[model samples]
Target: MEKPFSDYWKEYLNIQNAPCGQVGDTNEDTLNLLKNSDVVCSVRFEYRNCRTRIPVLMKMEDGYKAIYPHLSAYPKESEAQLMKINIQIAQSAGVHITSNEIIYLNKEYIRKDYLDLNEFLLRSDHLFNRRNKPSKTIDECMEQYDFDLDEWIDTVQTLLDSPEFTLDRSKKCTTGRRCSYYDDCFDESKLPDDSILFLTTSSHKLQAYANGIRRISDLEPEDIEGFKLQYAQYMASKHGIFYDKVALKIWTSMIQYPISYLDFEWDTFAIPPYENMKAFDVLCFQYSLHIEDVNHNLSHHDFFDTADCREKFILSLLETIPKKGSILVYNMEGAEKLRLKQLGEQFPKYKEQLDQICDRMIDLSKPFECGLFYDNRMRGHYSLKKVLPVFTDEYSYHQLSIQNGLNAVFTYRTFDSALPEQKQVIRQELSNYCKMDTFAEYVIFHGLEKYLKEDDVNA
Candidate 1:
């Protein structure tokens, strides 16, 4: 920023202009650029140590307008604070700030919201770290800033004045996931393998950790809100597994003949690509179905398409799934069943047929999700990927080119630009991945059936 109109900066931002007279170190390049251009993308500025990044700066007749693009469904409070703080930064930098708008590119739709800094809900006016607070890291201290100059100065002085150093394990909990320095910073290896700190519930884990409850064994029934998955996890930590044979039997009994294990892989577009699709609607482009008859003959059925797949996807599914049997889907509420419902809504003509299929659909995950079946090997998680290994190690996502749904979606996204050979390979990998998913459901289903039959024989 010291060298205004620097070609490197312009090139980095991908907005290069030819021969703009820019005075060095005088903030003249920004003025020159604004004078010539209607809009500037990603105008960067630093004020009061906190970073101010404006995505779009439009030269308006009145003054200037800042447009911040928010990609998520809901903007976080901290994000809003950072956005509003830009107005203060622009004022400091002598850019006449008139209005700020947030252009939401959310999953629902594109929306523009005018931000009134007068309300200033994100206003901050201080420096001293709260007694309970972990002192700001080096990066935080150096980059701290405020709308109020006095408060910004206080932030600097407070950092210089020295603050209490509190070690926050929770910070390590998440930062460790991605940060390489985490291993050196915290020795979580000291904690038990089944540490209560690893509980999925954040509030509960933090509370228990604060109370010095270290291991999973230390947690009692009273600690959890109610019985179910958490209780299964707690008990399994001691016993290594939990199998309510009776409950599992009941779940297994619900299955009719010629059971079909269903799985869907779909791409979610922020903007609706198809006519009937709403924003964030998933286009069901691929499916894998495994049907097992009474005689134990297994057949595989699948469909995949890159373009205009909505109608074909529905028709293929209806044709593939047998008319007279149970349709078993893992995570019915979220995945396969939901896809069916959406397809039905999108194609009203096929709603009756889709509903018929939906009626036959049964969630195969009921036993594991409800804690009727659990294995410590699952590590307190019940996703098909997590649950698959307990039943058999013969199959694994690691062995496949496309390991998960997201990978399949990402690969399909590149299909349009792919070379002919690449296209064929991509198509095959996509099919294999989806096939594996339905097969995984079958593996689990078969395991359950075998478990029930063996239990009955022993009884």
Candidate 2:
């Protein structure tokens, strides 16, 4: 595992082929261990094929190492060139292996019983035996890692660079849901406002980052659109080229057919609340649907402050929403669609109607997700909170009673348990927050249309 190849596998492929012992317990112990040998060989299985042991040869007490095949009959120097070289190197110096006896004639490799770091920790009860307690924060961990996050980032970037590897833009990053680094690396704000990720790329966002374009400003929408007009046009346009201001204008101006802006807030309790439900039952409690008749005048209908009436409330929501109108929601791809699908599954009798409702659902988040719209003030974030701020000076979550969905849901859950005075205050807060979501959508829709129509707006 000499310099290049040792780093090659470890950094690029995360494949470690090294001895299974801790190095340098004490300088004296390490010196004693290496004194009898000038050379050492270690073998460890590669993760992809656990059955195969990769042999690594190292100069004892030195970092220099190599990986040569293991076998019987030390080849004569007159024959087999690579083997002869290895044998000469081995014979001249004292060779050390797992077994004290290193037979010069026959080298053997044994299949290993393997355990990963996590599995080893769990088996030793180091992970699970700990009591629930406050843990070190990011700053603390950073201090332990030499307080050089830039170095770690450089290491990761260097490892990520590759001409052969690319992203599959058509598919979602499957590991995102489970990875601990998901938020740290792939959070919405980390991407560029005009990144190929927001538009269309053949590889994932990280790959794009490694390719020297960490932000949305790095993309060319015209080039992307030229390649694939339908889905990837937004990616190709460097100056927002493919964004059809006229098409967006047409959609926004069609405020007829009794328009509605819809939003829902739900909670998943660790313990089941309803019958036949296991732990982590997602209960949809609050729904705010703001409707406008043909005149574009707005009135809102809401369902909230219910704990025991989930089924009854859902039925009420179904009745409140009109069948034909466009149903607007933020991030419907993840939030609205998942909720509706779950609702349909829970109520088989109304599955067809629920599916139909989903069919008419219009995602208000399209512009942000597509990178057709961006605001410098947002700092490359498209969350509802960030997007809503750019729309109107009159609107804000800061002055509201409930500023976020999580807090709103928590308040709704406890509203009934509060005294009469607290109940009124909380109910008003919940109402105000939910109303703001719909109102923000209304403002954001108009803002996007305005942006699209503006001649000077950047891509």
User: Which candidate achieves the best TM-score against the true structure?
Assistant: 1
Mind sharing the TM-score for model 2? 0.50
Instruction: Report the lDDT tens digits of candidate 1 across residue range 1-459.
Output: 113323333343344643333223234455556667877765755555554456667778888876554433333334444644676667777887665554332233321242221221121222124342324432243254446655866877787788654456665556437467556666766665467765554457777878988766678768875757777777777777778888887778888989898888988865455566655678888898899998989999889897769999988988888998898898898877788898888889999999899899998888888888877777656888988998999999889998877788899889888999998999899999999988999999888877778878999
List the candidate 1 regions with Cα displacement exceeding 4 Å: 1-28, 37-39, 48-51, 60-62, 72-79, 105-167, 171-193, 210-212
For each candidate, what TM-score against the reference? 0.76, 0.50
Q: How close is candidate 1 to the true structure, as a TM-score?
A: 0.76
Instruction: Give a tens-digit lDDT track for model 2, residues 1-459.
Output: 014323332332233543332332332333344454443233321211111222344453433244333122232222223322333333323333221111111112111242122211111101111232224322232233323334544666666685554333323444335455445545666545555555333444456555776545455443333323323233333443345565566666654467688888888743334543323446777788888776778888998746656667668878998877788889987786777786676667877888888888888887666555555545444688988877787889998978999898778878777999998898888888988898888888767766765754664
Model 2 ranges off by over 4 Å: 1-243, 246-256, 276-278, 451-459
